[model samples]
Target: MKNIRNFCIIAHIDHGKSTLADRLLDYTGSVTDREKQDQLLDSMDLERERGITIKSHAIQMDFEYKGEKFILNLIDTPGHVDFSYEVSRSIAACEGALLIVDAAQSIQAQTISNLYLALENDLEIIPVLNKVDLPSANPEEVTDDIVELLGCAPEDVIHASGKTGFGVDNILAAVIERIPAPVGNVDEPLQALVFDSVYNPFRGVETYFRVINGEIKKGQKIKFVATDKSYFADEVGTLKLNQVIKQSVKAGDVGYLITGIKDAREVKVGDTITDSANPTINPIDGFEDVKPMVFAGIYPVDTDEFEELRSSMEKLQLNDASLVFAPESSAALGFGFRCGFLGMLHMEIIQERLEREFNMTVITTVPNVSYYAFTRKDPDTPVIVNNPTDLPDPSSIDRVEEPYIKATIITKSDFVGNVMSLCIEKRGQITNQTYLTPERVELSFDMPLAEIVFDFYDRLKTVSKGYASFDYTPIGMRTSKLVRVDILLNAQPVDALSALIHADNAVHIGKKMCEKLKELIPRQQFDIPIQAAIGAKIISRETTKALRKDVTAKCYGGDISRKRKLLEKQKKGKKRMRQVGNVEVPQEAFMAVLKLND
Candidate 1:
């Protein structure tokens, strides 16, 4: 255990965290000949599809230096700000971090943010300059920048091209030399911190943790500090912490536990796993109360597929304990769940997975920030609402508070004005600004979490010509004029199509919703009026033309069989839709309204 070095790779988005992780695995011979992928740490299909590290993945390796065996446990963390909390928790489990910086791109806002977090945790920092093989590589300049930024000696910098495998051996050596060995007493009772977890259909919940004290083994009875429940550990799984050998993981080690606990609700990520005999005096921190800022209702396209949707979400939650859900029933839309997530990115990931992994189509309402409001008469009491239909009487509302975030944008100086103007238009208040480099500036602002969530990231890149990088952290709540925008089909309200928006932007928001409805919802069997209304006044309206008749007028005896089959298919298709009076609306009608731009 003294030879083990546990570290995590931190960097901004596209700074090559996953690529560097792959290079480390390749250099240490951890990746087998048959299993070499470009970015191996991004194991999820969605991660690969999105080209982002949405989740933290860990792998172990063995490297030999000066005739001594060194074990390296590396965790790959998400670069996006939406998952910053996950990144923080990942850093909590590591003793060191490989701060990967693009030689050409220099340091980004997230680089500084994550670096500060790593420093706060007192983790040893090994600065690595990646992408040195690129044409714009400036190793010397970036090295100097890092030295000044991190206050580390220039000689300590590790220059490496993870893409070309250049200088990878030196990076590995630096890990062994610079990262301190795990320090703890093995004689103490077993205690481990559950930093991350994944759901395996075969093994149920596979929890990854760092053994903080004592020893853990297969068949040992363990107790969770959060749940106060005792369970027998079925087995302890070993990662490739050097060579492939089965051994009981003890204190100062990193590994996984596979208990036959199918219910993910029982085991949370940040829970303490300890020996039932003598729980450690300082138990691991219980799961942090991660509040889901974005609230959306998810429903299947076909009502019959509701069961499948629930099953998929349950399975997904087994791996992601951060997601929150509650069964919600709508008079017009049947049964669905009001799902809450950390932010928009989290919601998108879950939506994409359900469509791709479970082979089910789903409709999602527009993402909304939960609000707390009180009516004039009920000033002392507050109401929390996600759906507009649940909004308390406007007359009763005394004040409303919305969640806001402190956002930091790092971009080339050329985009500073554009970003400032864009943020100002979105109700953002400039807080602070700093020059990261002669050509780059870091701008901080207090913006509503809802403002920057949906397309702000892509818009930032577009306006800045892909030179802008950003990160954000929550900064509590603030007073705002938030209201519910109701969507009407024909003359009745469609609960699923309702959205919460700032009152000032309701008219513009309604127009956008109408446009998105045209793109998201298919034509109905009858002309459906998609109208956004405030109170009884309609702000925006568009009609979707009725779908053409599927059954032909003439049917021969032989063709009658085919016509019957066609009729049966049409009937089954109609079964997937809900009829509200004369209009035949698909589940997507509600979902399309959520994505106004799409």
Candidate 2:
């Protein structure tokens, strides 16, 4: 335990956390030159292509410093705010973190976020200034920012170029010298924290954990404290960049525990693992499971693929336990799943993986955050409303509350005016704003998560000319005037098309949706009425005209009365058709309403 170092790299997105991991691997000779790949720890293809770590990954590396052999368990965490829960869990398992800052960009929102999380966990932070080899590199200035922000010594800060492998040796030496070793009793009962898990085709569910005390072996009986399920350890191994099966994993070590459990739900993340015969006294603190914040309905393009879609979602859930789903049926779109996500990016990555990885065509409804509706009958019990269709009548509700977030944006001072305007437009209330540096400012706002979840980030980037970075954490709910706007097709309400909207922009938003639907929906044999309404009151309406045909041309050579009779009969038939015809809204129309711009 004295020779082991358990630490993770923390940084903002595109700040070279992964690049540093690659360099460390190269310097330690963990993987030969022929076997090493760029961003070697990032397992997902989506991660490499997008240049961001979506999932937190851990690998055991062997490093030698001054003829002393040491074991380094390096956990690479995702920098996105959406995966902050996962980040926190990873930090909890480690004793120290390498806080990476861009030499040119200095400190950003996520960098501060990671710093706070590390502080909360009471982990030692090693500030490393990365990308010092770039033309715009300003290590001295960034080092100063770190010193002022974190109050660390000037000499304590390390200057390194993760891109060029400069100061790589110094960074490793600091880990061995400054970072404390794990302090766990080797003779105590087995106690491990399951931080992450993965589902395998042949091995079933594989649980990755950090051994806090005692030891675990292949034949030992282990129990999951949360699930209360006991099983014989089928396999035990340590992660050596890849899995290396071993008979036993000792205290203060990170390894996988395979119990032949096929269901990932049974062996959930954040659950504790202990010896079944002599279990640990208590589970580790801060083991709360992650809850979904935003929701959207996911439907298959073809009705026959509903079962296939369900199966694929189940398999995906085995890997992503945060993704919540249940059977949902839409009148216009058929059977689907109403899925919940940690945030918008998590929702998008899941959608992309489903379509690309599983080879499935699926349509997703507009994303919406959860709301709390206090009903007149049950005013004390606020009903959690995830779907717009679940909301009661406006007269029967006391008040509605939507989720709000404390959003922080760090950008150049030149774009503060533009950013303030955009935030105000999104119903953002400026809580605080201060200049972090002479040229860069930190803008804080208490705003609804719904607003930031939508195109707010893209707009901020555009207004700031890509100079701004954003981060947000939910700050509970706020009371507001919100209403459910229902889109009606041919006078029938579509459950899936309903949206909970703020009352101020309800009318304009409804009218815009009606217009976009009118353009996307195909013309039928009869006129299709597209209307947006709140309860029984219609706010906006648009009509798709019926296909015109020259039915009277066949009677062109006949008598006038014959043509008149034919026209009269056609008019009556049209009236009857309008009464009984059902509007067939194409799949594209629903998607158009989601992406429609006002």
Candidate 3:
């Protein structure tokens, strides 16, 4: 146990976390030369293509220091704010963390947020400055920033270049000397914290856990405390580049356990694993349930495949425990699930994964944040409104409280005005501002969660020329003047197009929605009137003109009575078609609502 070191890498996006992890792996001789690759721990193809880490991956490394062998368990975590929950879970399973910051970018919003998470867990922090070899790297300036932020000596900061493997040895030596090993007694009852799990089609679900007490042996009868389900361990192994079979994994170590449990729900992340004969008294603490920031409906393109989509989501949820969902049905989209995501990026990734991995074509409705609605009859109890169509009638609604978030944005001082303007336009109130350096500034704002759901991030990047880094945390619910806007087609309400928006912007947004729909919805035999309404009042309207047939052209040079008769006959046919014709909304129209700002 004294020679075991368990730690994770945490940083802001594109701060060389994965690259530094690769350096550590190579320095420890964990991978062969043939297996060497960039962002090696990022196993997902989507992660590699986008040059980002989406999943938190764990692997073990063996290092020899001064002729003494040491075991190192390194968990690589995603840097994006959307995956902050993943970082939190990873932090819970480790005793220490490597706080990597880009020398060029200094400290950004996500870096500060992730640092706070590590500090809250009481993990040992090791500051490292990465990418020092780049021409733009200012190691001295970043080192000072680290000293002020972490309150550590200037010399304690390790300057490293992941590209050239400069300070990799120093990092390894610091881990062994600074970070404490797992403290547990082997004689105690087995207690392992399940940090993560993945679904295997052939082997059932594979659970990765950190053993805090006692030891687990191959083929031991184990039980998950949360689910109270027992199963024989089919396999026990350590997570390496490949799984290394072990006869026993003792206390103060991280490993994998397979119980051949085919059902994904049987193995829950953050649950406790203990010996069935002598179970632990309590489950692990400090691990909280994930809070999703965005809510959106995900329905199958084909209605009949509802069951298949459900199964796919279950399997996907096993891999991504942060994803929360429940069965929901839409009037226009039919049977589907209302999924809660961490952010827009997380939502988009899930949608793409469903298509690529499960071959499930799905339609995602306009994403919105959960709101609390209080009705006149039930003023004390608030109704949770995740879908706009679920909102009660306007007359009955006493008050509506929307979720607000504390946004932290770090950017260059030159773009401060632009960033401030964008936030204010989104109904954001400036809370604080500080100049980290003469040229770098950090701005804080209190903004409604719904305001930033659409295009805030993209617009912020554009305004700041991609120099800004944004991170947010839900503050709480605040009462707001919000109205539900419903889009109607030919006097019929389309529930899927309804949205809950602030009353001040409702009219303008309604007009935009009506105009956008006009361009996307194709013309029919009869006029299709598109209306945006709030309660019983119509706020905006647009019409797609009918595709008229020239009945008079066919009766050229004929008598005026003959032409009139033909026109009347055409009008009657059109009226009949209008009564029976159903508007087939193209798939593009559902997606168009999301890009209304474009």
Best by TM-score: 3
Which model scores highest in lDDT?
3
- lDDT for residue 214 in candidate 2, whole number 0-100: 91
- The segments of candidate 2 whose C-alpha lies over 4 angstroms from its true place after superposition are 300-311, 327-329, 553-588
Each model's lDDT: 0.81, 0.87, 0.93
TM-score of each: 0.89, 0.94, 0.98
Clashing pairs in model 3, backbone N/Cα/C closer than 3 A: none
> Which candidate order results from sorting by lDDT in descending order?
3, 2, 1
Error of 2 at 143 (Å): 1.3
TM-score of 2: 0.94
Off by over 4 Å in 1: 241-245, 304-308, 515-527, 544-582, 586-598
Q: Summing lDDT over every window of 10 consecutive residues in candidate 3, give the lowest-scoring window.
A: 585-594
Estimate, for each residue in 94-117, the C-alpha lDDT of model 3 and write its tens digit: 999999999998999999999999
**Total clashing pairs for each candidate:** 5, 0, 0
| lDDT of each residue in 148-229, candidate 2, tens digit only | 9899999998889877899999999999998889989889999998888887878888889999999999999999998999
lDDT of 1 at 515: 72
